[model samples]
Target: MQENFEDQESVEIQVGSEENLKIFIVNKTLLREASNYCRRRFALELKYEEEPIILNGFEPLIFEIFLQWISNPAPRITYDPDRLPQEPWLSNAATAWLLGKKLQCSDEFDKYALSQFVQNCAFMTFGPWELIEKEATTGSLSRFSDHWVAWNYRLAGPGRNEYSGLRAARATLTAPVRDPRTFDIEHWYSDCGKYMRPRCLHDPITRLEKLEEAKRPKPIPPAEWGRSTELRRERPQ
Candidate 1:
């Protein structure tokens, strides 16, 4: 949903250089929900009725999406810049993109909030591994490494589709590394790959063949008594 800023509580944020700087008015709630930095700043200003908050060293477009996410009627909806047709796992990419933007803010509280967002969103979406793989591919380098490793500790959590978890892991292992987000992916691959391979289902062709083989009945062997009877009949009395 497009948020109509009119008639809502607004805060002026100073962005860019004085000549290049632009003042943008944003809704207090939108900022608070998306970023802890925005939340705290808004809290102080709301209490004191302070001057416009000055924020420097950030791009307008990134901030625009950051604002848009929280303001969205369907934040649960994955954001794709191209608005490409989504696959079942497309949310993974969207989550990765959102968390990446969160990292750019360079706020400790905001970072924590984004991490929490990922955790909660992953559970709700029933796609933790997709989120994990997405983190490696899209999230910040050092942060995502730690986050990806943390997933092994959360292996095959109940109520999740185990095959989907393994499939996501399969995607992560095979997907090309994007630095610095995935600089360590290769390093982590050997071990995580070992864990995932067995659990991930065989490809459709292999599975179908296996199923057919399993369904085919085995032929019954002839009775063992016939050979024994002939030997006994030939024996001298």
Candidate 2:
């Protein structure tokens, strides 16, 4: 009797930010504290208002990430003094340290294990979608929020090996198309009347001068009939 044979491919897979993942796994609380400190100091720039105003695209899961990030920041990426921004995200190393610290503080589970859970959340919440070409589809924030919240439920542990499975399950979840530039340009032109004036280019403030001049009557031009008499008195013209 001949036996039927089936071939299947098994491949090792990699996912998410390895550096962040490693750091987070190594320590949790230290990362949390550092991130929190950075947020309190630099929070002004990150917010449209004193509190971060949730916009159309802002995800609640991202807010959770934000809370974590504020609690523990990544360390400074750049050491070159001149090139650094006025403020920096906690460095990847610093974050790793913080993550390690967080792991030490919490009894919820192994710090490394929880880091993996948080990492899973981060990956699912912020992962970039592959390029696909198709008809555009629009979605509401509520729909997006609900989807992420569901994903959040799946992060039971690091070794669960669920990322790929979840991704496969949601294979039809398409990335949102950006608004077309042409429409934006048209909208700008429509609003141009609010900001534009038909004034001299060389001196934009010339409009103010023109207004002042208008308030004072211009000296009347000499009459055409008196031109010859005035010219005669000045010179025999």
Candidate 3:
């Protein structure tokens, strides 16, 4: 599978005081290796981009995991105007962590600790996507922590104005959904559901509705395979 996509060839890492770390100019291999490091240490997946060309020599970035502590001795809210219009859902994890920190909840503490772990592991989280027809398409393998942040914020409120790239992708499909008849879950499943949690099918009716798409079966038949050769040939040369 690694052979099929471009692999990052190199990367540089830097550590700082109080979780002020930075990762500059990284490639796919480096990103994967760093994510594996987080997985081993924190039991969490570090989302990232899949395209090697898109990630080639990406600029090093800084993330402040301990910023919320500098003044209040814990994680606090700080919004960046540069990162707008806010998505309220993006604050879920961070807020949960903040609450756990305040109430001393063990589970929340664990999640908070893992969040810190991922942050310390990769000071900043960003991703690359394939822009097709004015839409952003993320890769399945990519770990999108920033998107999570956006969702957390979106769920947090009406006071903020930030948006999650992940939500934006979903909104893209659902936005102009006037008729709902033009809706096609088959393509949606192929593009997104392939990476969703299995528990997503908890509702039998929902499962049945989705299964009606023909591609929702456990194993897709070989005949359903599309023009891969043509797709591959069209890739950036």
Q: lDDT per model, in order? A: 0.45, 0.29, 0.32
Candidate 3 residue 233 Cα shift, in angstroms, is 67
Give me candidate 1's TM-score against the actual structure: 0.36
What CA RMSD would you report for each candidate? 15.0, 22.3, 20.6
Taking all chains together, each candidate's TM-score versus the true structure is 0.36, 0.16, 0.20
Residue-wise C-alpha lDDT for candidate 3, range 42-134, written one tens digit per residue: 223235542212212211121122222221244322223233322222322333333233323333233333334233322223222222112
Model 1 lowest lDDT segment of ten? 176-185
Clashing pairs in 1: 17-21
* lDDT per residue as tens, model 1, 100-186: 354343333234333333333333445344444554453333244333433433454444443444433334443323221212223
Q: Count of backbone clashes for each model? A: 1, 26, 33
**Model 2, position 133: C-alpha lDDT score:** 10
Give the Å shift of residue 121 in candidate 3.
8.4
